[model samples]
Target chain A: MRKITAALLITGLVSAGFAAKEEKKENLFEKKLMQDIKVLNEKIENLYKLHVKECAPEYIAKAEAYLDAIDGMSYINPDTGQIERTEISPMDKIIFENKARKYLAIAKEKVYSDADGDGIPCYQEIEQGTNPFEAEKKVSRAETEMKEQKVSEKPEVKKVGYQPLKMHARIHFDFDKYNIKKDYLPYLNVITRYLKAHDNLKIKIVGYTDSIGSKEYNDRLARKRAEAIKKYLIDHGISPDRIEIIGKGKEDYLFDNNTPLNRFTNRRAEFFVMEPTESQ
Target chain B: MRLLTAVIFSIFLTAGSYAETTTTELLDEAQNSIKAAFESGCPTYAPYEYYKAETYYRIAREETSKLNTKAGDAAAIKAIEWALKAMAKRYGEE
Candidate 1:
């Protein structure tokens, strides 16, 4: 009987050890992470409604990849093991959440940026209510056809809407990035329209950077910034032949690198307009 | 003389082939395992488990530096377990 009791006791102890080993750890950030993910999902959906996918496809793609990473996360019902919960460490959750928010902001900016410098946003033009895009133009097909045909020939210069003296404009860019900000897009729109109206005027866009990064990197970044403006103008209707892009890098600075505003002043794309010999 | 011989014999039997593992060895093993799990993309796919593994490994190193062999061994063992869990999570098994 003593031997049987010893055997039973040993079996009980071994089973208890196995039970302890099988218990799963609880995920601590289940509640907060779930809330954050829900909010991010709603923000992404709102951006989709604004048609961000068409304007800023890269940002949308990154946002989608981050959202996909949430799959296979932990926090399944610790009691019943029924439903899987959104489960990641607080640091990782913050990383993913902040990335999603950043991308969403970029996408939203692209959707709402004013393409023609009109007070109305691009989304307002795209939305089905009024469609001010074609309706507000009011130009006859004959005039548009004439304009298209004139592109290959010597074109008659139209009076530019903005003041001619405003030709020397500088647009500031975000730190270490080439994406044009929404505030600058309206000014760039004015430049695009001016270029379209005056094909004989060749404008050189000089890019500059702050004294922060390495020389080589700053030169490349400056070139990219100029190229970004060139691409925007070309996309809007400017002839590629009438525009020149140059990267001046960090050679010219408006202020010493002592403050944030000083650095911002240095990170700019400056325009210099020149008339052809015949126009002069 | 016989009692001394028996005592030594018993001590030899008890200590036979039982080389005690040091905290250094446990921590080194855990570090390698954690690195392997990270290379398997545990930080992206099994973020929580990987975080736990990294945290336990840090605690193990701190305890070992302080000469707290018992706590160091415990934390190193936990780090190894969490690393395995992270790898298992990557395979959709954990």
Candidate 2:
């Protein structure tokens, strides 16, 4: 009877151990999904700003497409063990929808005006003094054809032999939080190994934010996020002092601000590895 | 007299090994807990708390290596707790 009890106890302990391990894995997966959602939201916001600032009227269609794409994304629900899809969680959907609606309404208002005092809407009329649609006047097909004729007449220039150091790398972060995601540990491990293998390597991490808030706020947030990434590197056996963090905020627009879809390109973390002795 | 001494020495060695094993297990559990907290989003923790968690984890790992089971186990548990606390604070968790 004592032997049987001992066997039973060991069996119970082993089963419990396996159950705990499985639970831990499930939690990690959920965290990863949340991180992805956070990033997606930031991207949507960033793209919208870029569309507004750079493309103007073109952003309307881009914004719509982005929203459509966002709505189409789906993920496996860790809790339910099923798939689920939504542009944003019910908690976040209202905030984002309101933001999108605000931008769309403004864009429509600016682009379409009842200029002729008719009930029908038309494009905004230009003031007699101010320039008209810049795209219309900026270039002409006749001028392009003339330029192409001239370019064809000239000899092709030799390609430059200079090789640029490959600096571009994408870093992942957890949802709504600036902390580095655990999945990045593998990439970081590779980076560390590469650096240790190559003593003369120099790198710079540029952090940025989607254009959602004031420029100043985004700037601070970007800097903090970058610093956090640098800290993670230090914690993971990398030399802390060597890494540099730069915050560009919304100054560097990767996408248009017209729609949620286009804005995603702007919310990202970029790493630029430089050749040793390169100027900062 | 020598035989008695041998028996006492053997008992001490066995006891030491048992204590060491217990501490090692505790430290392992603690480390696992810390990882679990981090994996769970250390939701409320300030970055400093994660840093503290790492510090305690290292201490635990070090002590465990040295066979200082008691301190090692305590440090490991503390490390995991700190990690969770940091995440919880960051996430605004109760």
Candidate 3:
């Protein structure tokens, strides 16, 4: 007897829950409300289909507010003096419907209006012209031109067998002396001035000697000649680390070392600007 | 010494370069304008302006690659102007 009574109570509770849910659904989808807002409701559905919310959100929102307002209209029944949803007057329905229509019309107009705002509608632009977006065509053409330019800019690298000297002045040293001649000071100043203007550069001084002496003695003498140039540069405010000195010592002769003029040419200090690529 | 200073200054000018710091700042301004235009869908609505802007940006890039900072900065200014034009058109400001 206790089990049967418990089952009956459970069923009663379940039925009450279902009854509440049904009542709520009927309140929203009642025949009167459905009939009153039928056209606008379908239009709203179409607007959703079109994703028109982005185009005219203000109008769409206002139209939705009017639909919610319809639920507020009510009147008291004369017999029972109780408020009911069914007594909603035709005037209220019409007012809401008209406002909804106005907003929807504006929204639809915005959705279908001319995109360019060139005073010609998109539809008309399409009807009269072959291309609706001529301005976009110009961009497309420019993009094509840019692609052609990219292709033409590609070319094979030509590697040269020798690197041309990136330097200006070459000073000749006196025979058997490592001292810098005062006559060469103007030329040295030229390099110093260039270095001052471009601080992002390093200098290399290569000293050469004639074959008149032993390799060891010539190498030391050549180094001294290069050192003299380095000191001059440092005196002019260039950093010491920015200068590199090398002594070729009777190698890479400019002319036959037999003639005095040839030996003078051989006893020379050459300068090279260290290109940034090779500096690393 | 003053005459020497004047000569050195003139040679520095003839060295084919401009103030790097100023040019870099201008290029940054241009890049910001370009980013705003792209995010705002200006390329679709304002294609002509977008094309002009990108072209000027390309010029700026090329000039920068050649170490022509002054010309690069000028091109960047043009790019910034055109990108702003594209955004204005998108916003119905033009």
Q: Give one digit per residue, the lDDT tens place, for model 3 in B1-94.
A: 9999999999888774653446667778888898899898776566557655765676566557767554566567767877998888677442
Give the per-residue lDDT digits (tens) of candidate 3, residues A1-280.
9999999999999999999999887666566667757767888888765545434444665566456445442333333556543223445445655777787788677556665545554334333221222333454367457645643453222131122233635688777898988767887898999888877677878888877779999999999999999999999998998888898888876555543434666788888765444323
Model 1 docking grade: incorrect
| Residue pairs in clash, model 3 | none
Better of 2 and 3 by lDDT: 3
List each candidate's DockQ score.
Answer: 0.02, 0.01, 0.01
Better of 1 and 2 by DockQ: 1
Q: Write the per-residue lDDT of candidate 1 for residues A1-280, one digit (tens) a residue.
A: 9999999999999999877655422243556666777888888788877855444555765565455334322322323445443333345446656766787787788678765555566566444222222333433244345535654343355333111222567787768988887767877887777777876677878899988879999999999999999998888888888778899888766555543434665788988675654333
Between which residue pairs do clashes occur in model 1? Answer: none
Q: Model 2, A167-275: lDDT tens per residue?
A: 3455633323577766456766777777667666555677777667788888887787788867877776667656777988776554444433223445557665545
Cα lDDT for residue B79, candidate 3 = 77
Error of 3 at A145 (Å): 40
- All models: lDDT? 0.67, 0.53, 0.66
DockQ of structure 2: 0.01
Cα error, candidate 3, residue A191 (Å): 0.2
Regions of model 3 farther than 4 Å from truth:
A1-165, A278-280, B1-94
Chain A: TM-score in each candidate? 0.42, 0.39, 0.41
